[model samples]
Target: MLAMGEVHTGLLQNSGEISESTCRQVLGLMAGETVRVSRRPIPHALSPERLTGVDCALPSASRSRIRGVGTVVSRCAVTGGRVAQGSSYVRVVRSEADRRLPWSHYLSRPGVVEVLGKAKAADLAEGFVGDPAPGCLDMGAISGRFLDLVQASPLLDRRAPFRIPRTSLRWVAETGEPSIRFTLHTEQERTLRLTHPGPFTPAVVDLCEDLATHDWLLTSLLIIVERARIGATPGAQAVARLAPAIDHLLHLWMPAARVEEWLRPFWESLERQPGFTRQWRSLVDRVRDQIATSTLALLSAATEAGRR
Candidate 1:
């Protein structure tokens, strides 16, 4: 794809490498009549730059594809040399060649997020490319949505909805024990099946629990941090430090980019502050470890839930 920043930077330029059919598919998804793409040389392998990651802007008619926004993450032994397995980066991949490349191919691998559908893809693009969360706003939005969904669910009663329709309420209803959100949209009947097993159901449940719990931890922690910056109890300061760290530990399965961007800054902030007492740091570390343990347990839960 065309690199927005580099296109103007007078970088190595190439001609069309994408087939017409692929371009049509991409344009259809984009809902754009006219679209432009750039081609680049792709060795069988990659040459990682000194940076493990870089922000790339790809121009597109719509915001749907990369257009002056998007960041690519990769694993590099050197600056930009070899890409390790499971080292997929984010981009508006459209062509077969685009998807065939290792950086694009690995994104679909298990343990990585497969943001199905345009809506979810937009969210992913926004999170990666657009200004995300903007500090606590993202945290607040997550909390608000989670609580709304939880409140919407049947509280472990009323058969707890054995099955939920694929509507806006799909994600909320999915919290029920032993639930599987169907891969195929109910309307479209495709004769496809995943060659590999989906993530363990137990892990999904655990992740759900962790996410549910995180609403409280991060939202509350942010509140405490704001109040304490003006000076509060050593105890209060200690509590703030622990919240984001635990959030990190619990969110282990998430894309590292998201985790690093969201939680790491907060952890660093707490570390730099004078409020944490020795005992407080110890307590926070303990909770962080607990979150780590819980993350692994989550996978088991998701797996077990699938079995039942």
Candidate 2:
């Protein structure tokens, strides 16, 4: 069995981070289900998972007609009440029968899709991680729509400080030798391939979401830093460009905050290679240095004016 999912991450369309109550109101998707909130390392809120039924062709490298039927799990999340994300995923498994089954059968097993006919896990994984052909199972779209739903909520003012595009992270996990591979295909597209030593679990999903959250943070910060034009523009002006990031993003970089303990090695391994935290800290330090220099310049000018 393979667990494939996508997460869409972006800024919450509000001038500032929303309050806990507001976060609840914005993420309240299902009627009876509760929105879970954690306030330790950061104020995070996650909506109850909602299932969407799908009967589509599984992405195949050889363009095979591997039709699958099941519900896809989706939910919206708010991190520090500033970053919003929509996640959707489905577990793919081969079915005993070779044809379509009743809707209720799929409905009963939420977030599990049964593929009809023969299909190789590697083929599907390759097709998905690479450029997927049109009309394949589109978890990215489902996740994006969920994000759009939250962004369009009346609770928000639709006044995001920065207008950065959302980042989409597609991931696939299978049981194997416990390794992780993260690839950035484009500014907005990323993919992760994971091999765990045991059976697939929700912890895998948590790890993916956590990585997606941090990756989006790093991407957004880089954009902000470039826009600051540190040396090209006046120090004060550059600092002004970075103000929104300091206000809304810098403090939200607690990696693996939600990941299970045993799975932390995966994050640590990535840290050694691409060095997500290393780059993030460098950006943070640059932002701070710019702010400090600008402040000093302003202070010196004020003192000189008073003396004159």
Candidate 3:
């Protein structure tokens, strides 16, 4: 649906956030469930104001916010990874496991709503010996190696140095458990909880990331909207909103006409992007290639899990 260069070009045109209308269209395509929408502000937890460029760990979904449901819980390991030191835990008290959370949940702590968060962006980009400059535009489809970072097992940028900040799959293999643990916990100290089974494996991890990243691609999109509030003109402004094409993947079930219709106004606000035309071809191909490879690896791993 993304057709070749469109998705990444959109990413180049718009930084990372994808508009909600586009998200609904994309999600409708991929799932059987009805897609819901809500709008809210970013949480203080993941706020740069709180961390002050410290590059803190990804924000955790707050169980406190969601109302009257079965409990929501999440556990994370702060092992010797690139960010954070102490362990992390989240629980939506009395919330249902499948319960829909408040929209704010997606803003500050991306884990609750979207798969790939700012932490993933800043940290995941590590270890590239020859990546363009830090300021250069980074546009491309989601890659497979990146999908590995989504898994509960440990993740490392393929280019990580062999020293302390390791990136290979070794930690998971060594632990015989997914190094990045996630679970439902009851107490601050985790007196009660639910946990995902061993290995958390390459397949499940990426699947979760894909789910979350899709959401991230949608909601945090308000970030671009927020940028527009300041009166920045299109092309004159850095990319901030969803491109019409990206909705294809997330809003798979939506009618194409409605998607384009929704995107029409948003399009009027576009700021022209520089260089997106020049570097787009090879970058898009590279991203698609990565996706193709990751798709196979995840499917094979999931298939084995099912067979077991």
Each candidate: what lDDT? Answer: 0.27, 0.93, 0.24
How large is the C-alpha RMSD of every model relative to the true structure?
A: 23.2, 0.9, 24.0
Please write out the lDDT profile of model 1 over residues 1-308, one tens digit for every residue.
11100000000111212243333332231233333332222111112211122223322224343322223332111000111111122223334322223544443432222222232333432243233333211222222232233223232122211121111111111111232222222231101111113322322322222222222223333343444342234443444554543433223212212122322433233235422233344444555554465566678889999999
Best by the TM-score measure: 2
When summed lDDT is taken over every stretch of 10 residues in candidate 3, the lowest stretch is 1-10
Error of 1 at 205 (Å): 13
**191-300: candidate 2 lDDT, tens digit per residue:** 99999888988888989989999999999999999988989998888999999999989999999999998899999999999999999999999999888888899999
Residue 180's lDDT within candidate 2 is 90
TM-score of 1: 0.20
Span of 10 residues, lowest total lDDT, candidate 2: 124-133
Report the C-alpha lDDT of model 3 over 188-262, residue by residue, as the tens digit: 110111122342222332223222222223322333334333224432122222232223222221111112232
For candidate 2, the TM-score is: 0.98
Q: Which regions of candidate 3 deviate over 4 angstroms?
A: 1-194, 230-308
Candidate 2 local accuracy as lDDT? 0.93
**Alpha carbon lDDT at 218, candidate 1:** 33
